[model samples]
Every structure is written in C-alpha cells, then in structure tokens.
Target chain A: MSSIHEITLMLNGDPVEAAVAAHTLLVDFLRDSHALRGVKRSCDMQVCGACTVLVDGRPVSSCTMLAVDADGASVVTIEGLGGPDGLDPVQEAFLEHGALQCGFCTPGFILATKALLATNPSPSREEIVHHLSGNICRCTGYQKIIEAVESLAR
Target chain B: MLPRPFTYHRPTSLDEAVTLMARHVDDVSPYAGGTELLLAMKMHFADYEHLVDLKRISELRAVKRNGGTLSIGALATHAAIAADAAIQGSLPALAGLCGSIANARVRAAGTIGGNLCFAEPRADPPVLLAALDAQLCLISARGERHVAASQFITGALETVRAPDEILLRIDIPLTARSTRYERVVHGHRTVAGAAAVIAQDAHAAPRVWLGCVATHPVALPNAEAHVAANPGVLDNALTQAIASDIARLDIADDEDASADYRRHLATTVAIRAITATVEQEERA
Candidate 1:
C-alpha cells in the first residue's frame, strides 16, 4: 500500500511541485516525472556519484534520497546549472579539458565540481581530490577531470 | 534499483518521530539521509513497511559542546560534523573520521547516529567514538536512556537500540590528552581502523581506549597495564604482545579481506595509533 506525497521543492531555482509515491527516489522523480535526465543513474548505490544533485545547495546522491525527504528543499540538477548565456564554468572546464570520454559520468562530476567550487572557491588539488572522491569516472583517467577543477581553482 | 514501497512519515519533532516509530515498531525505520537505508532496501537486504523520516526534526541537528562533553545531534550530517569548529577544537580525530566517511555525497547526506546504529564492522565512527567513550541518547515512546558508545554496537549491523527507539544524540567526553584515529586508507570505508585516546595524569598512568581491532571497541586494560608497568616502553616485542592481545577477539572475514589479514591490519593500525598518542602523551 504505497502512499502518494505532494512534495514542493525549488528545482533549479524554480518552485516545482509534484505528486510522487512515498518510495519514489529523487533521481527517478526528476528523470521520469519532471523529464530532467541530466541526473545520470549510473550507480544506484551512493558510492557512484552519477546521480549527484545539489539539495539545499549541498551535493546529495539523488538515487539514495527519497523524493519526500527532499520536500521544500532547493535542488539543483546538471540541467539547472546552465544559464541563458552559456554552459556553466564546470561544463566549460570539462569541455576545455576533454574530461569526458563517454560522457556518462560527466553530469555527476560536473555537479560535484560545481558544489565544491561554490563552497571552496579556491580548493587545492588535494582538496579537490578529497572532495570529489565519491564520483567515479570510467574514462579519461580522471587526470583531466582533476585538471578541469584545478583550472577553475587557478 | 529503487527500494520496495514503504510508507513515509515525516515528523518535525523527536516526540512525533518516536511515536511514529513506536506505532509501527516492528516495521518502521527512522530515516535520516537515507544513504545507507535506501541502499540496503535497494539491495533487497532490508524492507520496512514504514519509514519515519527524521530529517525534518530540527532538534536533532545540533553539533555543539556543552558541559565538558561534545553533544552531537543524531541528525547532524557527516559534513556538518566534520566541519564543526567545536568538534575540530576538541576532537579533531573524530572530525577527521567524520570527514573521511564514504565520499562527499555521503558526508553531505549520512548522519553520525545512522552510521553508529548500522554498526558495520568496517565502520569508522564507532571505532573512534567507542575509543573516546561517547554516549548515545536513545528516545522512544516508552522513555529515554543514554547508552555508552562502547555498548551500543553489539555485533556487525546490530545495535542495542530497540526498533521502537530513536537515537537522539551522541555525547563524547572531550578529555583525551591527545587523540588520533589512524586509518589504513582514506576515500573508502576502513577495512581496519584504530582510534586511540590518551589521558595521562600525575595521579595515575595514562588511560587508553582501543577500537576496531575486535568485534567491538574495547578498553585495553591488559595492554594499558602493560604500558603503564613499563613507562619508558621502547620495545617492539611489547608492541607485538599488545597487538596480539588486542586481536584476541573474534575478527570475522568477508570479501573486504581475510580474518587473518583483518586482524593483522587491525593490530598494525592499533599499534601505530597507540604509539602515536603515547609518544604525544610522553612529550606533554
């Protein structure tokens, strides 16, 4: 007997309300219901950061988070990071660094990077490595990803 | 993989949370960040008929030091705990331990109470918290009681907390002369972890508590007595003896590593942690 919940959250700077199941995961809720596919569900488990999204400005694994838990919170997906002007600095950096090989893990890494930079604008290389350890990328060897963030730090 | 359907109840206060849990005692799980709970449910390792969401409870978001003890609210996220100035000032090792849990996303989502309640053998907080003589406040519709961190974790993935009870807060005495949590690695849950808290007084020898080398974190009365007896201890043999003694408990093995390897790693970590604080204690 699953129950439906009316969750009103600020999605990507806009107040979006939806009716979701009690067991609806945030990733699926965003992707399936809201048609926000930027949150890649690579690792359903929290270990892989493919489903990373900013909840209340803090990066949270949407796959592990319940949709109801995010009610009334502000959530930022990869799609939300983009402005009318152009790509976000993180996306541009990834593109400039050729950080993505398959691009599957790009959204997670980009979101994590965005959160990291927002909090610690001048994170050291060690800091960047330490903070982003949760997101796993299978391609590009992560050297370019680190460099991408490093470039932002500089 | 999405978890099986479970009714969700978001309670804004501790009383409401506990009562909701008590109403569905056998089937309700108090949800925090849902980092571990959802993962377990998705893996088909757990199923709950109801989940009492505790995240909205503001009382459980405390991270402060009051009356000589660092009182950490159960709902405080790992990232908050790690970044807390009070925790850093009093128990940097605990802060460091919290900071290194899983990853950035988990640190942002997971809470200290949830981590300790899970009681995974490969856990980090219990190891350090137990060593630091932390106390946990448990609340239920029945009543409330404080349990020592050392006694909270009875076994792997098992805790003394009743299904109807919710862990409200964690209180750790900020008393160690110098504390150090030495891990085998970072960016991963520790296969083996050693946390050492040293308190040296003119009235008595240094008191030491050891954790993560056994099924549960334990007081090294045997090893402490040995170290106290030999105040200027500089022998490798004694360290080996202490290590073996600490590893006397049953250390189980899973895919992470073999029992022997786990014990061996535990011994190494314990010895290193002990030696580190002991040296600091002696210097001070």
Candidate 2:
C-alpha cells in the first residue's frame, strides 16, 4: 500500500511543508503541487537533465528522486534562482550570449551551471563541459551556453 | 512516469534498516541513491511493495582510512567518494574514475553500493574494485558475511546479496602500488572497460579485469599472465595476449555495439590499462 509522508524542506530558501506520496517524483512535486513549471520534464529516465534540481547544493535528477527524499533537505528549483528584481547572473549570461533558441533546456543548464560554480567558482572550459554534460540542449548547439558559462568563469 | 505506489520506510540506523528489510524480505528493496532503482520502476521494469530508504543511516556514509585499508560506507555517493581525502590519498585512480561516472548529476546522487548492487553490465566500479581486490561486507538480521568484490556480482543486474541483507561497506587494502582504468564510452555509458593493477610487491601477479563488455567483470587471466611474464613490456605480444583473452569471452551483438567491435574495444582498453600501469610503475 502507498504511504503519505509529511515532509518539511527549504525550497528556494523558503521553508515549505507538504504531504507527498511515496511514489511522487520530485519533478512532479515541484511542477504539479507548487506550480513551479520552470523545472521541465523531458527525459524522465535521468538521462536528460531537463528535470535537474539542486538538492543540498548538489545537482540531482529530480525526475528520478522521490519527493519524500527531500525532507529535511534544501532544494532549489529553477524558480528559486532569480528574484522579482532581476534574473540570476547565470540567466543573464545566457541571455547576453544568446545561449538559448528554445528555452526548454535553459533552466536545467543554468541550474547545473549554478551548482558547478558553487563548488568551483572558476571552472575551466573542460570542467564546464564535463559538469554540464548531463544537461542536454538540442538548440543552439551548446556553443553559446559554453561561451556564457566561460564568461562567468574567473 | 511515476513508479507504482509502495510503502516508504526511512530508517535512521543500519539495524533499523535491516530489520525493516528482514520483515518485508521478498517484497522490499533497500533504497540508496535511487539512480537505477527509480528509473527501472518508472519504466515499469521492476517494482517492489516496500522501499527501505537508507539515506538517514549516517554510519553507512563514512569514508575513512583505517591503517592499511580504506573503508568506504555503502551509501557513499560517487561525488562523495571522489572528493574524499582518504580515497584520494590511497587510490587516486578510483577517485578519478568515480568523478567521471555517468555525469555530474549522477555522480552527485549515485552511490557505489547502489551501482554494485544493481550490477549493471556497463557500470564502472565493479571492474576497478574487482581489480583492487576490494571486499564487501553485507549484514542481515541473521548475521554478517564478507565477499570479495571479484565474486560479488554474478551477472547483469544480479548479485549474491540476499533480499534481507544490506551491503554495509567496501574495504579495499592499499597494496597496489600502481593501477589504471581505461574505458571506451559510446555515449554516457561505457562500451568497454578494463582495469589493471600491479601490487606493491613486484613478485605478486598483476590483476586485470574487463567490464562493460560482458554480463559481469571477468578476470583476464591471459592478460594478467602476460603482464606477469613480461614485467615492463607493452609490445605487440602483450596486445596479442589481451586480444586472445578477449576473443574467448562469449560476447553478443547489442544495439550499443557488435560482438566483434566490443572485442576490439575491450582489447584496446585492456592493452591501454596494462600499458598505463607499466608506465606508472616505471615512473615510480
């Protein structure tokens, strides 16, 4: 039988609580329950990084993670990155470099970049490529994305 | 797609986790990073009525060096293993391999225990761990037992671990003076992988294992014998030895690669791995 878990976690710096079913995936929880549609669901198999999210400062495949697993952890969705004032630096970099043609993959790429920059503030070109390898983007051929992230590298 | 509904048990201790597993035996699975298990469940390939989440068991995440052995807790994530100072100091090659497994997200979420337990034919850790002569400690309500990494995996997605048992940790002795792991990746998955190790005592026979080219990691006895016979050689004879050994394995054509192509790739990696170890030995 399915069980309901009452989970309390920090979402995008805000404390939130919910009752999630055992089988509810984190991607569905964010998009459906919280209406955070910025986290897209393309490849539910974890191969595609379209459903990427930061759990405790590390990038994880939200499509494969259960919502209940996020209890007591801090999760950051794409919606959590920017504010009403302005876009996140990673998003701004993408905009300036024309890194996106279709924006379906932008959020995942940006968040993955954010996670990379968190641990390695100045990742080399190879490091950036390696870190974002999981996040696939069919549009723009990834040149602009690499350039955008490279510009941010110190 | 969402997995079929099941009861989730979050056990804070290893004993609690095993107790839950024993109680639910045939219907339960001990959940780790869920990188493989959840994906399989979503695809409707495998389903369990109960899942005992082992994340909260802190003891299962430790990575420490105890004298001559490196003890890696079962729940240690690939990222954790890669960044660990103990593993880096004792077996930097393993740390490097862990860093490159799958991708960044997978590295952050997938654990070595989960990888071994799932026993995916294309997985990376098994071949390298087997070559290192690592030991796995499994615990159950009845008792605990130790098994060699080389014999832990029986086949693809198959292991000797009983349903009521939980893999506690992996203990690797720091006896190898030089080690190298080489693989050919078609995409994110490895098409073929080879690991070679030369023990600190020069007289000991070299260990060589091939993975991702078969159902489980297979010891390349002929390749090991070649390395043993020719201590510091990377010649055509060595290549022939690896090729001949690979030819004997029963490989099948799959969508990723053909049998002949896999054999070729396996030989290339095996030779490269042995050559790398030899080069490292010379440098030392």
Using DockQ as the measure, the top candidate is 2
In TM-score terms, candidate 1 sits at: 0.95
- lDDT per residue for candidate 2 within A2-117, as digits (tens), equals 89999999999999999999999999999999999989999787787999999999999899999999999999988898899999999999999999988999889999999999
Those runs of model 2 whose alpha carbons end farther than 4 Å from true positions after fitting are none
Candidate 1 residue pairs that clash: none
Candidate lDDT (C-alpha), each: 0.82, 0.93
lDDT of 1 by residue, B1-284 (tens): 77888888988878778779989997988888777888899888999999888888888998877877889999898999889998888888888888888999999999988988877666778878877778999999879999998789887688999999899999987777877888775346576777766654534544455545456666666666666676547577657666667666777766667778877776777677778887886788
Model 2, B18-92: lDDT tens digits are 889999997999999999999999988989999999999999999989999999999999999998887888899
Candidate 2, residue B229: CA error in Å?
A: 1.0
- Could you give me the TM-score of model 2 versus the true structure? 0.98
